[model samples]
Target: MRGKNVLITGGARGIGFGIAKAVAQMGGNIVCLDSLPEPVEEFKELPQRFGVKTHYFRTDVTKESSLYKSFKDAVDTVGDLHGCLTAAGVALDKPFQEHTWEESRRILEVNCIGTFFSVQLAAKQMEKQGTGGSIVTIASIAAQGNTCPGQRLSIYNMSKGAVKAFVGPLAVELAPQKIRVNSISPGITRTPMTAALAIQYPNLVKMFDRVPPLGRMGSPEDIANAAVFLLSDASPYVTGADWLVDGGLHAGTSRSLKDPSEQ
Candidate 1:
């Protein structure tokens, strides 16, 4: 990925930040976009530590205007993009009956609509450059369905399902342009967002452990490593595929069949 300009939405923190660091290590210049306040210290040290150029733009992925302008500015600052990671998203879980219209709308706007525009605009820029690029969106295992028994996330699940569905069509549509489109479906990962959940509901920690057969929750670095692979030259032929980064959760939890004494 050396000399490749990669744009990462929600790159200010968490998995997105992890992806940024990994890309820098691979010698790729980075354009980190997030609605959150700039991580001035981290961004400053990135170039010096990784020996690559880095730029950050505050962007709200929900708005097409904001997204397009940010993409344009990012391209102008760093040159044409070779890859884009659409990691900006939100997760709000509530029972179907209790969910207010406002809450459901926010989740759909951020997780589905925001992702849609982010990928669309990035592909447009990549198309204009006449150079094929890779685009990765952060879907979730929730798209499959809500796993935790007590958790109510009808709307959140629906939002992610939309993202999972969007990737296939977008990938096929952009195939002629050589712009690969893909998504990552992560399980219960230890992120800032989940940290709050853990604090609010201590029992969720235990619930999360039981879901992934690996006997542990995932980390930002875990998913970041996967994203880097898709963005790198190593996966030129890959597109339209949803990569499950949830450690064995999607495959079903492991279990002991019987005791040795029984045999």
Candidate 2:
């Protein structure tokens, strides 16, 4: 990743920030596009910590105009984009019947529409550069199964589902241009978003322990490790694929069988 410039949406915090740190550690320049008015304090320390160029732009992914302008500015500052990660998303937890039309719309706009345009802008720039690049979107295990367990997240699931569905076709289309498109479907990662969910549904904390075969919730670093591979040259042949970093949650049931003696 040396001399490469990777752009990350939602890079101000959480998994996105983790990816930025990981890329920086690999000697890649970092460009962060987030809705936050200013980059987080930790973002300011990237240069000193990793000796890499870091830039942050306040951009809302839902608006194509905002995304276009911010992306252009990022390119002007960082030179050319070699990799991108569409991590800006929103999650909603409400019973399907109780979900308002407005609530559903917001989730779709932020998670689905936001990702669509972010990837589009990145691909366009990479296409123009003619240098080819890698694009990774952050989907969720919820797209593959009911990850929330007892809680309801019908709309949120749908949004991420759209992300996972599009990567394959997009990869095929972009392959001719030497661009790779893929997604990472994470399961029950510990982020500020899930921390809030844990408060709303306290049982989620317990389920995190019992669910994944790894016997623990995933960290931002766990997901970042996968993003790093997809973004780097190591995955040249990998594209249009969805990597599940769910600690075997998608492989099979994690529940242990009861012993016959106990029964």
Candidate 3:
């Protein structure tokens, strides 16, 4: 990854920031596009900390105009983009019947539409550069199946499910250009977003504690590790694949009906 410039949406915090740090650690220059008014302190310190170039632009992925301008600015600042991760997304936890049309629209706009355009802009840049690049989108285990039983995420699930489905065809389309597109579906990761969710609904914490076969919630680094792999040259042949980093949560229940001795 050394000398490569990777673009990361939502790079101001959480899983995005973790991936940015991982990229920097691998000696890659980073260009961050987030809706934050300004870059955070840690993000600001990346250049000196990692001895690599770093740039941040305030970008709202839902609006193609905003995304286009920010993307142009990012390319002007960082040079050719070799990798991208579309991680800007939102979540809602209301029951399907109770969900308002407005609430549904917001989640779809931010998660689905946002991811769509971000990938488009990144691919455009990579295509123009004529340099094969890797693109990774953030999906969720919720899209695969209901990981959180009681917590309703109908709209959120639909949005991410759209993302998971979108990757395969895009991968095939981009293959001719040597651009790889894939997604990472994370389980219950400990991010500020999930922390707030857990606080609002205490049961979520218990679910996080018990559900994963790994016996713990995931960390930003856990997901970041996978993103780094997909972004780096190590995964040249890997594309159009949705990597599930859910600690075996999606594999099925860890519990058995009877003990081995009883059997």
Can you write out model 3's per-residue Cα lDDT over 1-263, one digit (the tens) per residue?
99999999999998999999999999999998999887667887788988999988999998889999999899888889999999999998877899999989999999999999899989999999999899999999988957465678999999999999999999999999999999999988998888888778987676786667786789999999999999999999999999999878897644531246623
- Provide the lDDT at 245 for model 1: 89
TM-score of candidate 1 to 2 decimals: 0.93
lDDT of each: 0.85, 0.89, 0.90
Off by over 4 Å in 3: 256-263
lDDT of 1 by residue, 61-153 (tens): 887888888988998898789999988888775567999989889899988888888887888889999999999999888887656445777
In model 1, state the lDDT of residue 36: 90
List, residue by residue over 89-181, the lDDT tens digit for candidate 2.
Answer: 888887899999998999999899999989998999999999999999999998895664576889998898999999999999999999999
Residue pairs in collision within model 3: none
Question: Each model's TM-score, in the order given?
Answer: 0.93, 0.95, 0.95
Ranking by lDDT: 3, 2, 1
